[model samples]
Target: MTQAKADIGVYGLGTMGSALALNLAEQGFRVAVTNRETAWIGDFVKEAGPLATALIPAETLESFVSAIKTPRTILFMIPSGAPMDAMIEAVLPLLAEGDTIIDGGNADFNDTRRRFKELSGTGAHFVGMGVSGGAKGARHGPSMMVGGTQHSWDQLRPMAEAIAAKFEDDPCVAHLGPDGAGHFVKTVHNGIEYADMQMIAEVYGLLRDGAGWDAPRIGALFEGWQEGPLSSYLIEVSAAALLTVDPETGQPMVDVIVDQAGQKGTGRWTVIEALKMGESANTIEAAVGARGWSSEKSKREIAEPLLTAGTLEAAIPSETDLEAALIAARIIAHAQGFRLLGAASEEFDWSLDMVRISEIWRAGCIIRSALLDDLATAFRDEVPHGHVILSPNIAETLAQKLPSLRRVVVAGASLGTALPALSAALAWYDSTRRGRGTTNLIQAQRDFFGAHGFARTDQDGKFNAVWPDLASEGT
Candidate 1:
């Protein structure tokens, strides 16, 4: 138990871990770095370059723990779940009072809370830090969302922000809240990522199926959209992927790609949490379902003969029409995802600052883009809990573009191309315009049958239409 006060001690020298360590070292932080295998340490040191001398290879957990100063901060970059649990168990005995452990892996939020409680007895702090952006972003600066004690967060903020991505002079990292909030936000971020990617796929499918356009032409259309409201990193990459030709066949490489999609468990977890919280996350849920369904592509193909098919030969809409539709659908999908995040925040009592969350996602996170700035601005101008789609600016944006989006959805449905996010967004708009239909009907029925009071449509009165005679005294 030696007094220690270093900037970072990063364990597990994988790509993400190494990149983060490099970022910290570049920021002039004294980072003690180690991995389980000694050989990997040399490779990490080499990859880290000038930062190599600062890297300390710890052969044992005791040494790793002892290397950091008091109020010690050690970050775990290991595989999540059981492996992480085992590591925590191994290191807990070696850590001194007031030492902090940051779990930077994608561990479940519940596990974070449990670990936080378990470590508190030793006066040790546990911080669940949600680190996003891929390998490259990690080295440059990734978005970070952290949850733990306010005191612990305050201690970590400077270093975290120093190594974070920035947007319009604001760092793309924040103290989300206490306990599990960081991982929770990160979970929702993944859910939105799923929806965003699916929406892009739908746009690509509509263009390819309806226009008979080659991949390069479709890629060009995406490139044009990238300069407009529909612009995003996902769209940018998709356009590039479409333009790449297979060296062997000289055909568009996208054509040879499998129609199926894959997903990790985060999207599913988001959908489940949304269900538990009674939130409308149709777009996000649909995206998850779409991926699951796509995984059964072979079965779908087998069943195709039994299903009626429609031709996708409708005339291609104008670029303006396509752009407007895509933009509107994307906005709606994003709204649904944000709405879910809001609901989860409230449900979990996270007290999360929506504006900050939006700002973070506007830059280095996977969902980062210029569009999120508009979303953040919109959130800042209104009641924090206001319905996202009902925000004045968002409403106007959706109103002007809904028709074209509807047309796209119809075309996608007819062509049998999966467009779950598009469909969910369309349905959300419809429900918003008409009012949510199912719950109202159920409430009305409940009032009619059981005298459970319901609001009257004609007036402000609370009334009940009773079926008392049917439950007769004679019976």
Candidate 2:
């Protein structure tokens, strides 16, 4: 057993796992590390350099478990679906009562829930933890969302908070409910991230295609935006990407790269869950759809010339209007995400803290922004209408910024630009403000075709409208 007693056991030496192991070691916590490829364990320890003193290398799963102290806390940083299940099956036998197993990946929340239930009678505890901020954040400080039993939280809290990102000296880590709450929140965070990136890309397209602005010019503008309400990690990176010059070709780095966008299913999961819950996340849905459309590179290339709409010389919107439009669309997208979280919280009895979620997201996550500070403030008390956007401060901000979104969407439509995410955000916002909606006609049509009942606003119960038979009338 090598006589190595450690505070935590880290299984897997993937990019994220290695970074996190190093992070734990740097924080003065002894971390026992192992990998499926046993040879890599030595290399990982070597790469860790001075931090190697704190990393205990174990060649086998048994050795890994043995190196950790009693009532062990083991973190498996592997792929989410089947691999995680397999790891759980493999490790459960080696653990004892009061031991904890953590799944630290972008997991499907349903699976997290199932795993939690699966371990109910077993003595070992299961935790589903969401770690954000990418590999760099893992090595330094990442925002962490933890979900598990109170016992598991108590076991993991000290190490988790020690390695987590900070907002004004406050660690960006929280024990958010139990079972699937952490993973679910992370999914929605990625969904909002998708919308945020798509909206930013749309504005970049507008500047590049419609206004004929150079990449550096657009990049400079985005950099300046970081000082305002739009300040966030995505904006910072987008600016950095745009401003970078290719050494070999002397062109902008972004210009040389392929235009196709890639996704890893988290955004799609968010949309699917929202739909299943009878909620609307149109902006996120649109962002997912854009990524799908981006994947059809060959089809897009073939249809480019054949599907041309007559081009118009559209007026370019001012930078002020463009910034305002981004802020407005961003607000609506995040609001929709929050509503979905609220719905899930109610549905599963998670009792998620919206204010804390927003607060943690202010630093380490990809969607971290100055806007999240405002969102945290907005959710500090009960929102007026069960929605963040309806809060007085948020409502006033949206009212001030909405016209710019309208103008930008109109301009994009006129210019034949594909602004799916921005357009969807505007559409959702417009629908939200209307006390009466067009869905009544949809209900009427459903009743006419399928005898589905429709509720009348003037009456108490559902009623089917009497209508002329379409077949008889046509005959």
Candidate achieving the largest lDDT: 2
CA RMSD of all predictions = 3.6, 1.2
Q: In candidate 2, what are the lDDT values of residues 1-475, reduced to their tens digit?
A: 4656999999989999999999999999999999999999999999889999999999999989999998999999999999999988999999999999999999999999999999988999999999999999999999999889999999899999899999998889899998999999999999999999999999999999888999999999999999988999999999999999999999999999998999999999999999999999999999999999999999999998999767676788899999999999999999999999999999999999999999999888889999999999999978976799999999999999999998898889889888999999999998989999999999999998899999998889989989888798885
Q: TM-scores for all candidates?
A: 0.91, 0.98
Number of backbone clashes in candidate 1: 4
> For model 1, how does the per-residue alpha-carbon lDDT over 1-475 read when each residue is reduced to its tens digit?
7333456689988989988988888888888878888788877778777776666667677777777767788899988888888988888888877778899988788888888878777877899999999888889989998999886887788899999998877899999988888988898888888888888887787778666778999898888878877778888888999999999899999888888888778888888888887777788888988888888988989998988776655555677777787788778777877777778778778888878888998878888877798888888987434677788888888899988887877777776766788889889789877854778789877877777888866799787774657556776
Which segments of candidate 1 are over 4 A away from where they belong? 1-6, 310-313, 436-440, 443-475
State the TM-score for model 2.
Answer: 0.98
Which residue pairs show collisions in model 1?
3-70, 4-69, 4-70, 5-69
Q: In model 2, what is the error at residue 94, expressed in angstroms?
A: 0.7
Most accurate candidate by TM-score: 2
For each candidate, how many residue pairs have backbone atoms clashing (under 3 Å)?
Answer: 4, 0
Candidate 2 C-alpha error for residue 374, in Å: 0.5
